[model samples]
Target: MKKILPLLLIVLFSCSVHSQLNRTFMGKDIQYIEKNLKMKANKVQNLDNGLSRVIFIKEKDLGSSTIAKGEGTLDPMTTPPVSKKEYYTFILDNEGKVIRTDYQKEYEKK
Candidate 1:
């Protein structure tokens, strides 16, 4: 039973570590989006389809102003609709720079 005890402990420890890793990854993504994208993001959630998702609402205009129009219309006048053509699921490293991006397709019903 001595060997079994150690093995069980290792399994439990690994499971806890993996859960913590996921939380940290999600938090890093939130921070990166807030600082770099200048957007306020809703809480991250894992979808039933197994994708981690976050909704970022654009908050500031970086350089989208026009001389005549003042701040350009790039800012959504209202809450922007989620784009089916453009959406990103970002994979961030420990440093929080996007390591890769997975674009999601619009769901279709048969």
Candidate 2:
């Protein structure tokens, strides 16, 4: 029981840390984004317009399994999962300061 208690405490503490780190807001500084998300970005580029754009692409949300069919809800026991493509772009000025941020969703290709 003592060992189990320590393990649970460790998990809770780690969860707290992870949640804090995952907190994000718009208009954050370019440096902050670069420092935190460079490794995760699909592409980081300095444009000819003397600005930088860092793009992060993810399909992090999966649709629910329950679906409405013929006025009744049906839950598939084993079926394909659905996901949406998401794009996060951070636009930075010449001084490496963020000018704006854009989040876009595109239809997934079949």
Candidate 3:
């Protein structure tokens, strides 16, 4: 039982992490990107080398953005005067298979 418990825990954790990606456009084809990551995509670009990027306003929004756009929002008055958007990048192969996912570095808020 002890050995089985540890193995089961590892399987569940891995599934959780992978589910997070599966819930989004990650590991999916580029054709579905717009439908998947639109509203929060202040910007999106597809590169020649099978790389696509979607940009969002805040770190917290970045999470929601991946799941679906408009899931997160910012208040104009509370928002900082100078702020930058977070970038979510997807790497795909020639056949349009998602290779990996990465995010831009988050800078400290002043």
lDDT score, candidate 2? 0.66
Q: Is candidate 2 or candidate 3 better by TM-score?
A: 2
Off by over 4 Å in 1: 1-28, 47-51, 57-86, 91-100, 103-110
Q: For residues 8-45, could you state the per-residue lDDT of candidate 1 as single tens digits?
A: 99888756744543444444555755676555654465
> Residues 1-109, candidate 3, lDDT per residue (tens digit)?
9889999998888566456655675567765764665544465678776565544433542211222335455532233333355555666666776676655545544
TM-scores for all predictions: 0.27, 0.51, 0.40
**Tens digit per residue, CA lDDT, model 2, 56-107:** 7877556446543555445445334556776777777777766666666665
Model 3: per-residue Cα lDDT at residue 4: 100
Local distance difference test, per candidate?
0.48, 0.66, 0.57
Error of 1 at 35 (Å): 0.4
Deviation in Å, model 1, residue 37 alpha carbon: 0.3
Best by TM-score: 2
Off by over 4 Å in 3: 1-19, 39-80, 105-110
